[model samples]
Target: MRSSLLRVGVVAGASALVLATMPASLVSASPVTDPPAVDCQSVLAAPTLDAAFDAAAEAADVPSDLLRAVSYMQSRWEGHDGRVSNDGGYGMFNLKSTTTAVPDGAGKGSTDRSPRRTASQLERAAELTGIPASTVRSDDRANVCAAAALTASYAPDLNASTQPQRWTAAIARFGSADTFERQVLTTLREGRARTTSGGETVTLDGDPTVDVAPPSASDPETDCPPDLGCEWIPAGYEKLVPSDPDSTGNYGNHDKADRTGPGGPKLKYIVIHDTETAYDPTIGLVTDPGYLAWNYTIRSSDGHIANHLDPKDVGWHAGNWYVNAHSIGIEHEGWAGSAGWFTEAMYEQSAKLVRHLAHEHDIPLDRAHIIGHDQVPGVTSGATRNVHWDPGPYWDWEHYFDLVQAPIGQSAKNTSSVKAGDVVEVRGGYADNVNTITGCQQASPGSGDCVPGQGTNFVLAYQSPSLEAPLANDPGWKPNGAAGTTYASDISARIQSGHKLVVAEVRDEWLGVWWAGSLVWVHNPATRPVVLRTTAKTVTTTSTTAAPIFGRAYPEPEAYAPYEIPVQSIAPLEYTLGAGQTYAVSDDDVVTDYYYAQSFDGSIPDDRTDVKGELRYYQLWYAHKQVFVKADDVTLLDPGKRAVVPTRLPKITGEAKVGSALTVSNGRWSREVTDFRYTWLVGGRPVAGATGYTFTPRPADAGERVVAVVSVDDPALHPMLAPSLPTAKIQR
Candidate 1:
């Protein structure tokens, strides 16, 4: 819809002889040539450009053959204008802006501009002709004709060169010439010959070299139709049986597989896919006789599996032939961008299927070999510029890898020890499916919203030019949150021990690692041992002094502590700790004290005003201390002032039934459950039990929440209650 001009030119020397026969006024008019009609039915089609070439050659008084030769040189009449030249010129004729002018009638001027600055023959021709510059740059015909006329203008000089070796040298003067002239010339000559002389043609119809065989009973090479061999299985999966008793039949009707062959048993990569349609329809579509077939379809409900094709035959899944032939496609039912999260059962079953397929086919489970549909490269050289992006940003690579037991995280330790500008590999997951949250409110259970103000942090990383290279980022990223607002942060850096990792980028303290091609940061402190640093730093301490803490002063001291404490030697001083001076204590101490002073309750710290709802009861840990502070507190602890504190162990109540709400309370903080995560427990352990307060109960949980008792970390205060008195419980 945009418009621009095109410039055209011709050398003066050859003008005399060629134009002598034509009227002077006619020479200024645009050239005209017969249009080339091409069949567009096949995958490979010849481009149409006769009218454009003829006009330019005729106007320049150059041989049409020469114009054709130049067209062949530029793009082989492929009509692919987006092609980039070595010098950075884009599109057909590689026109430059210096000589091309926007056409008069073209809507906008100069819509098309080459990456290169130098004008080409096509640009000169567009200028000579009246066509707009943008049209010349984008229109195949205008570009071709303009190129021819410019080439013809140079014909005389080339003819006059006495040195036979200089023939190429003279042709090189044309702006449209390629850097590799010999190759260009050869291609031109071949194309000219093919056009002038009838050549063999390729078709997409039934092949002469191969014959389709009927579905046979015992032969493994027979063809099987869809419905006859497909049977539905649980979880929306279909098990496809080979019509031939031997199970060696080829069932695909397309060109993706070899119909006739000594081709080895069909074993290749497994293609992972997510159905854009709903679950039931996905199964119905794949099972229909006329519809497309894949090896398997996994249901999101419970991860039910179905098979529709045999491993020995190809499935019509990947758009690329090479990928289809060498890969087994498995379609998982669900919209990739839908709001719902991929069910745990579905992910588990998918992983099992993938593992089974990998073992059966000897395929390694790595990024290069196991990729999403979005990662499939273009099939042909020309197709590389146009790629499809699917299975989009919603898939969770970290969780998936964990299921597969794949390595993820930085291998080198001592992230802080690593200096700036140094290369390091940092690995972790970027929650692709996470939604952005801008307001303060309780997130629906299992919404996958990385809870803000709850210590969810993401590291910065960049995409590298080489897809295989590690990601990197500029150092120095610090974020601050506003009152009552929860900002989304990356949680990929929460690397723990036993996770898989590959070196991505090496930089001081920061490693850019790949988790599904998306770079995530891994911070390695320099103080830790290198061997211990390389592996994920799993949180080993169940009760961490560093656990975040938050609370507001009671309007009255008696409002919070209903029970009066008896005087004891071990009791801490009862002085109230200000927001800025909240402390952290060792979690391992057996008799550590907490100090709390009865004060005018209304004199709460200004930072305490930022507290909202349940968040007021928790604290954020920093540098190994349970700091009593509000989220909005601006004062930071001095480097040497941090307190060593005991770990805070989480206490869990018993599991509750599905569809029913459960309550979890630890000291002043409590949360109610309403989602799958809230009703389920993994290995009889509450999902968020490690965090000391939140609990996600599952329907099948084996009753009884495991409870642990540990000391709270605080440096400026002593225990208000006995060490064993402050405990949390999970109950329905």
Candidate 2:
């Protein structure tokens, strides 16, 4: 008999706060000049002020003419400082009023406060200019300066090369709703005013020099050398032919100007981009002449690749002149900073396109050269502070690299074999359960459980110059930083020093390494390994004892009851036997229903029955036999020891209603049963449990319930009373 009882306990909630802070690094400045206009009114009237706009633009390190055009577009040079719009925008630059507040003397506040009037605008500005709202609003000069700074954030090289087109994009970020003509005119007017006013002009390497080239006049044809691995094929060009095509290959009313330079160099890099729009919308926009154009548009569904621009001429993508001149841009249909997994088809097609392009161009498929918009270095040291982060963290670089079959080898020089005491560099990405990650989750540890399908949100662990080792922990973690409320440990696991590992290991999984004096891990996917090749060799061997035959013995004698012959055997093993296999054993008798068996590992003979028992409880009539076997040198033919089936206890048949008690007897055992687990089973599953031994008929419990219960003599010593093979009948 055994005792039966249930216990429950109450649970409590706990919380903790940890203080952490890191010094902010200074951002680099741009080399372009500022516009000449001082006030909104003056900027609206100016025209043909390229020189004046150039000077101001130079100060901002943005193209002088482009700045003038954008100023015309936004506020039309008609903005007033005291005036306010419905959206709470103010100032000549229409700076949003919603501003981010600095950490007050009081600890953490209930909400973040900023000068920017609208949350969205402030966020957009912050993203573009890389300037904190707290800094932007502190001074009027900074407000307009930051606005210009944000404009310069676009690819500088692109701006320099495609001044009109790239600058239009940079301004569009600030005034997307405005008409193109209005935007361009406003920027030009503002550019003229700023230049005349002698506003600051940006200089490169501290040198005040300007190289102004005339607008382009002719559209150049694409030319690929025979040896470059690219073939001129017209198969997909038909799909791109616009329905209402004009000379510029555009159908709409937007002005098209050809700025293709004279013979220089063929485009080499194929830059990938996302439209930051829905699929259908992106496709329409890319194909529309009125909107900006790229060389190709990749569909998300079938990964259907479409070509719209010639690879030879520059496409208005990447927002940088330098990049635009040498790169063929491919726009992927998607939204920026949105949560959505790219389809397998899209990845496959994109990989194919990239591989073909890589073969065509002499560019190496490596991170330093083949990078995301975020990785593009600033045009000058000063411009590094302001750059856009497109193709954000969600992109899976590792899987993409694998598709190209780039050589990813464990660096032979890596200290992977280093001992525990030795140091190594372990690196990898920090993705939750499903393996996506981002820069960092600036939250409390454990407060933010990793969301499934979302990429990691943390930075990579780099070796610290002072320490000659990777940081003890990922620097990306700080509760109050851009990531917000996420703890580093909660977001990423640790990798140690002296650990040798490849770069690909860090992107989609939890990666770490033993480095310096400890193991450290970081969430960075951009870092991947270089490509390589390998080969294999062969060796010889031998065998023994005809693979010793296997068998199974059951009804293990040790579990047998008194007077019970528990010997049963199964012949020559049919299946390949290995470790960890298990099987059940039962008696041959169907009516008697009493048997016992034990599970064993390794090989066992079909004739052998291992048994042990006390004389009072059980005994075997066979002559005493002893077998000697080494602890580890034995194999079990039987997958496992057999399972012992208990003998059926006698049933006390009767009928009772609702709460009546019942009793049954077996040999010398007699016990009263109350609330007995009464169930009936027709096939194999359970029916309903009834309180009485005999249940009344009910529609729901009509099916047989296989009732089972364990009886107990003492409250503490509870022994199970095996029920008779489930009796079937109505509850009545």
Whole-model lDDT per candidate = 0.37, 0.34
**TM-scores, all models, native as reference:** 0.29, 0.29
Steric clash count of candidate 1: 114
Worst 10 residues of 2 by lDDT: 618-627
Q: Compared with the true structure, what per-residue lDDT tens digits does model 2 show for residues 1-732?
A: 000100111222110100011013212132212211111111112242333344334444555555444443333332322333212344334555555333231112235443333244444444333344544443233344445544554333343335354344445444431233232433244332322112333221111123222322222332332222222222122213454333223222111122233332334356667656545566567655455666666655334456666554445566544445446676666443433334334555577667766777655564423545543323332233344444544455555666566522234332222211111232233233133333222321211223335543223443322223433431122212222212222221222111122221222322332211112333332234211211111000011111111111122344454433444331222111111111111111111111121111112221112232321111000000000111122222221322111245344444433354545444444445443444544343444563334553344444544333322222211212221222223333
Q: Can you tell me which runs of candidate 2 are displaced by over 4 Å?
A: 1-262, 410-453, 457-459, 462-732
RMSD from true fold, candidate 1: 29.5
In candidate 2, clashing pairs total: 142
Error of 1 at 9 (Å): 93
Tell how far residue 711 is off in model 2, in angstroms: 75
